[model samples]
Target: MIDVTMTRAYEMMVILYALSIVLYFIDYFYKQAKIRRTAFWIVSIVWVMQTVFFLLYIMEMKRFPVLTLIEGVYFYAWLLITISIILHCIARVDLPVFFINILGFIFVTIHLFAPDQVQNPLGESAVSEMLIIHISFAILSYATFTLTFVFSVLYLILYKILKKKKFSKLWSRLPSLQQISMWINSSILIGNPLFFISILLGLEWAFMTLEGLSVIDAKIIGSFIIFVIYLIILVLHRKGKLSGLNYSWANIYTFLLVVINFFLGSKLSNFHLWY
Candidate 1:
């Protein structure tokens, strides 16, 4: 029963993916200067198609699929795809189309193969629109930090390549080190205050949604740990200790917490494990 609508959406996504891959391949193997441009326009169209299906699912289900494990993974796939395409359009990095294509394929596989089911929320209190807004902003901020982590990994790889004095193929695919560094910094600059607001709103939501003012769930504690870690980083960054390996490692730690929350700790984690 789930497959009926889900499969239809999947088919649309696969079609878009197929087009994107073909366009990327054309842009790569052919080396036609205009091919990448065309590929981008095509990817944009595909994004519109996905938007339709993504919204359709949400509307039909009457809840955000992105709140669950399977749906969250799927959303990550969509996010990465969108990020890669948008960055390509704006930055024009020499990143190998190969890796990008491979990533696309991998996400597609997960989207197609992963389970699909309506994951219900835990408590039934009608959260305020502001609370949902807080969650959205928090999730977007989370996504930015996640992207920053990816960029840090890219920087490290590029650093290694430069140290060995070999321009590995990946170097071509990535933005310049200076540019990537700035991206990481600016992203955090934006994420920090948004994160702070998110935490404040989260506290209010907890009080409003739950029965008491002091109910500390395991999830609450887990989230607090992350919140504190990030808060420390932001403060230190203000004092200027956020650079080099220290920066990368901090991102790495945050990324791990993100994975836990997005996967194992999300509402649908257990269901995904058993589905």
Candidate 2:
């Protein structure tokens, strides 16, 4: 079964991710077009392998691999690739190969090298499918935020280039300012509805099970703060009240909040972290 295979698949992905990172870094500073292509090929092949691994995990476990630190790292790598693909699609931003690979590499490195922790498959068959929906969106929101953080960092680099009038490297590689702003908007649009619905379902599920008690724990607080911040950003963006600089700042802030929620907040606040 692929669930059993996931372990092997993860190991392979780590190797590939590391190799890709090395190649990408070499390509980035050396200005070798062929090296960049080779790096992307390595990344792409591993992503496909991991994609299959992910699908198999869901099938065997009947749950998204968002639980446990290791699985979370795996999913984070997938999220980075997904975001990179999306950004690549709409903006055609030629972000340094290693810039994207770094996040993926970190995830795999942690998964492979860090101490083992038990994974919590919270989607036990007993839970209602509705509850599953809540859990699904929770992961999706977190993943989206992960993507935003990476992109925001790239945006800052591009902005600096624009400021310095050094358009050679950054201008050629990154997306236009308008495209990055739109990317921010699109990430929010995808994440916002999912966040809203997930919370509602979470509350409903808890109410049905725990007599309407929603624990005001770290997990909930983290998610709530993230949602509120994004909501405000959405409003500001819509109203044209947020400058590109401010938008980038908000993206970074929200991403930091997401990370905290994933690690610290979830540990302190919610039962959600177990999964």
Candidate 3:
């Protein structure tokens, strides 16, 4: 009976989180301060509920919730939401907050619907702190990159609107294309170093624990590819070769590559599997 009740609670949490995502989107498009405020509170409430849920799981399992792939994703999403809330409060970037919640919602909803991986408490226990650090930084990098992608796309849309001279409430609410481009650039600048560190940590952990990792492994190769793309974009920007629409377009392409690398590479990588 308790299990069933907690299951229902979990579903309720998901529903509330999903609603918060919708409210955030509405706030973004409608340009309502009240709607944004409401969305923030909803996100805060759901974040608290998620924290409690994880605490309960920790008590029940007698370990951290990172023992399973689904639990890891949930925890990662929680971190992303927590960071988004902090940024929303400090920076007041509603569009980025909205898109960040969209990613969080998709991750948790997918975890709910997907088949569960077997709990490998023994293996999970054996995982080193270095490995955990690597994963945490990698997830953070992805979150930043997701923000970069959204801002770049927004820059493009706003550019189009300005070019067409289409004035609307949304247009008035949006930052200029130059400002959005700066956000994109900042995200990339931050994410690149973090992701680079994550790669180094991952390699170190692999060598220490698994003897070594294959260079050809899908995740490794894909990560390196992403790193190279990020480096290339930075170089181009420095050389004044990519800017404005070209800069945004490069980000769009990079984001697409990341999506494919995540979904496709994960499936094919033995080293990246949970169990």
Candidate 4:
């Protein structure tokens, strides 16, 4: 019964954390004070729950829960949440807080899913949990990139419409070209790092767990290719070699590669079972 209760509480905490992230995302883009306040309250609740869990673990273990990898991840996540709340209240640095929470959320998810200890030499369960973390990070990055693609498409449409002097209600409804471009840049800024981290974690897990795994596996190669392309795209944009319609088109094309790699690479991978 205690185990069941703890599991349920963790689930509730995760739900609230996810909701807070959504609220933060909205507040980030819309700059709505009420939404930001609500997100702050929700994050506060999550922090309290995390504190309760942290204390409980300490009491149960009779020590600080930071000696092992799993314990360290939980502690790191709690630290992130604590700092994010403090920053939200005092520093008023919005972007850093949001990104900190994102990192916290990833670690929290990993802690929730990972086994407390590896019981055997193989550690199959622990390896599987790491795979889940890898997939979670990858999907989150993909979602961010999808948002970037959408904004880029909108920017293109707006650019064409304005260039042709076709004024309509749509022009009023959409954000200005500069704002859309900023959103595109912000999404890429966040998404690229996330994808890179996912790739690193996935590679580490594979090396540790999978015997005789080849580096030329379809998914591995495809993911690396995609990462390199995005890095190049970001560098080009920074160097002013890619901008305006060309930048938007570059994003669109790269997203197509992401989609293809996601589907085709998964299908071709020998051990990439999750779909």
lDDT of each: 0.65, 0.71, 0.81, 0.79
Q: Ten residues in a row with the worst lDDT in model 3?
A: 117-126
TM-score of 1: 0.75
lDDT tens per residue, model 3, 129-149:
787777778777887888888
C-alpha TM-scores of all predictions: 0.75, 0.83, 0.87, 0.56
Q: Residue 263, candidate 1: how far off, in angstroms? A: 3.6
Candidate 1 lDDT: 0.65
Report the candidate with higher lDDT, 1 versus 3. Answer: 3
What TM-score quantifies how close candidate 4 is to the native fold? 0.56
Residue-wise C-alpha lDDT for candidate 2, range 1-275, written one tens digit per residue: 95457677778878887887787667656668888777777878887887887797687666655556566677767877766555545554556335666776777677667766544444353367666677677767766666566667767878888898888852475677777767667778888778888888877776675543556666776677778889998898799998678788988988887777767875675455453
Which candidate model has the greater TM-score, 2 or 4? 2
* Clash pairs (backbone) in predicted model 4: none
Q: Please name the candidate that would achieve the greatest TM-score relative to the true structure.
A: 3
Q: List the residue pairs that clash in candidate 1.
A: 94-172, 94-173, 95-172, 95-173
Winner by lDDT: 3
In model 3, the runs with Cα more than 4 Å from the true position are 25-32, 58-68, 121-126, 211-213
Report the lDDT tens digits of candidate 4 across residue range 206-255.
88877888888898898888889888888998899988999999999999
Q: In model 2, how large is the Cα lDDT of residue 17?
A: 74
> For model 3, what is the error of residue 110's alpha carbon versus the real structure, in angstroms, after optimal superposition?
1.6
- Model 1 alpha-carbon drift over 4 Å, by segment: 1-6, 18-35, 62-67, 94-111, 122-131, 168-170, 212-215, 234-240, 264-275
